[model samples]
Target: MSGTPATALDFPGEVVTQAHVRYVALPGVAGPLALVTLDNGLDHTRPSTFGPAGLRSLLAAADEIEAHTPAVSAVAVTGKPFIFSVGADLAFRSSLRDPEAARAGIHAIGELGHAALRRIGEGHFGGRKVPTFALVNGAAMGGGLEVALHCDYRALSSDVTALALPEVFLGLLPGWGGTQLLPNLVGADRAVTIAIENPLNQNRMLRAAQAFALGLADVLLEPADFLEEALRWAARVIRGEIDPAAARAPVRRGAVWA
Candidate 1:
């Protein structure tokens, strides 16, 4: 139809997801902790979704943080009030008419997402590789879950009721690193269960406890003080008070994975 809408901003009327960065002073953490908040400039009703424009916004935010003066010791990403993100904007997917156009759009979005999110894990900022944490404080689905997987560590909120990778159910694969990252984080079998099995079986989603048990997150905190607790937990991890490897021992051990 419309030549397969160009950028995620192709839809003139759609709201653009914005990545906002701010430095938070952690009590024990040495340098400033750069916190990136994803918001579509909307209320909780509209969960943030990454489109090309959104992905570009995120990259710019990372650029800003990396260029800061004093340099940051750690980096963390989180969502708005009640939502982290639901993944790629389905509106972009639904608008494509031509198969070739859809293919091109998907490729463009995938590349942008990879370039934007991978920096967190690569730890390329402030002349050294600082640690990264995904502070998942609310609902996260599809690409949202994948974004968390990009972080070196994930801190989830106990009140999160919906967490999933439902791409297969949506007639798409988890192209934006979910397929690879999920398997590596939780092992192959469990990754199959999450990335394929659950999506096939009625698009089942994971609750906070279920995801925590599955080893998707490093720690889970109460919702009442979710952000604060997540920050504190991140500080502990950065300060070496908490060992992520030890936290994931149960998952890495042969019992559950086997």
Candidate 2:
């Protein structure tokens, strides 16, 4: 679905997820790395989610990263302590009564997510072709997992137990690029298992090891120092010490994927 650029929407009692940007200097990596932390200002019990306001917040963070003076060499997006994000705010969608309005809202939301995330995968940060990383330190479901898929590389924490595109189980689809990007990443067969089969079969989610085995994550890290290890790995990759594409599965396209 497509629509005009998304504008922030107001909803009662919305727990707005805020994107906080901090620049980190990783050893052996040139220039500063823009690290975005997604938080909703609540405990882990309440996972961060993307509503209109939250999506706007991420767009604003992207703006900040683009506007940095020295120009960020790399970008990384992560979540709070044990939660990245759980995707769009279902509470906001459930409150809508008009079908037309719901359709418009869904389109707007999907458009916003695409706008905010596509740049990372495309290396379009202020016209500089820099790599992006998704340091998945915790649970990443639905749109959250889609966010990781948009990055050049993903580092998943071993402690993560919930990672899936459960939208099918909820009678919805992964409208925000999951359907297309996932199949391209892990092959159509594995992507079907993630986007369709597992969700249909009791909404099964992937632990970090399972996701790694399925080629969803480029690296699996321990939770105790996931952030640090991820940074080191990124530095190594940046310095030509590690080759990310070497570890990835061969790309399948044309009739092979079909």
Candidate 3:
């Protein structure tokens, strides 16, 4: 459990993929909020790159989170180093030993992530009665971006941290609710524009202000104040100082799908 898997190469300062997930409860004014940290310990790509095994581990990790979360009002730790998540591991996926197996595996993993997305975004977890937040300290692309969008609100870094959906370049669409989630967070126009545009041509990097303006990001803070800001924001909601219910905006129907 303390070492890397035999199938993986030995690398220094790398995030081991075995049990590469963890969860904890945050002490809030109302009750403890669940805080799950995704730790593929990846120096290159995300755990979503590992195919079926990775998907299984991710679902199992969510189960672990539920075990601790008998109560609601959860927030993800997008605030730490290697914070948030970096989408799928394209490098590793392209290197699959068997293309057929890899394709099937990617489909399965996408399904798993989509289900998890419904839980987080639709409020299935935390009783669907509590607000969830994703404190995105770093970049979140593809599935990672969808994860952040699954929450009611997002706290992003003021740095060059990006939030993108680049699934089109893969000869695939966003299967992990990214297409659905992005529109919900940002407006249909921006979301559809992003999806329609070629990711290979766009950087998709959003500064805190840009993220805030687009409504995809709720608040922006310096790296130093990021965690404090998120906690404070969540605490306010817990304390009845702010209206969390007024936060969500329905995704407008757009030309792409309809």
Considering every candidate listed, which one attains the maximal lDDT? 2
lDDT of 2 by residue, 68-155 (tens): 8788888899999999888989998897779998887777787887876775555566567888899999999999999999888999
Give the top-scoring candidate (TM-score).
2
Q: Which portions of model 2 show Cα errors greater than 4 Å?
A: 1-8, 254-256
Report how far off residue 113 is in candidate 1 (Å): 0.9
Superior by lDDT: candidate 1 or candidate 2: 2
Model 3 C-alpha RMSD to native: 5.6
lDDT of 2: 0.87
Q: What TM-score number comes out for model 3? A: 0.75
Poorest stretch of ten by lDDT in candidate 1: 1-10
TM-scores of all predicted structures:
0.91, 0.95, 0.75
**Model 3 ranges with Cα > 4 A deviation:** 1-28, 42-54, 97-99, 125-128, 198-204, 244-258
Q: For residues 1-258, write the lDDT of model 1, one tens digit per residue.
A: 112224553554456889899999888777899999999988989899987778778888888888987899999999998899998988877777799988877777777778787866666788899999999988899888888998899999998988999988989898779987887788877898998999999999899999999899988789999999999889988999879857574335466555
Residue 153 Cα positional deviation in candidate 3, in Å, after optimal superposition = 1.5
lDDT of 2 at 34: 90
- Model 3's alpha-carbon lDDT is 0.59
For residues 2-110, write the lDDT of model 3, one tens digit per residue: 1112232212333333323343434545446666555565453343232334434555555555555455555454523644665655554555568886675455555
Predicted candidate 1, C-alpha RMSD: 4.3
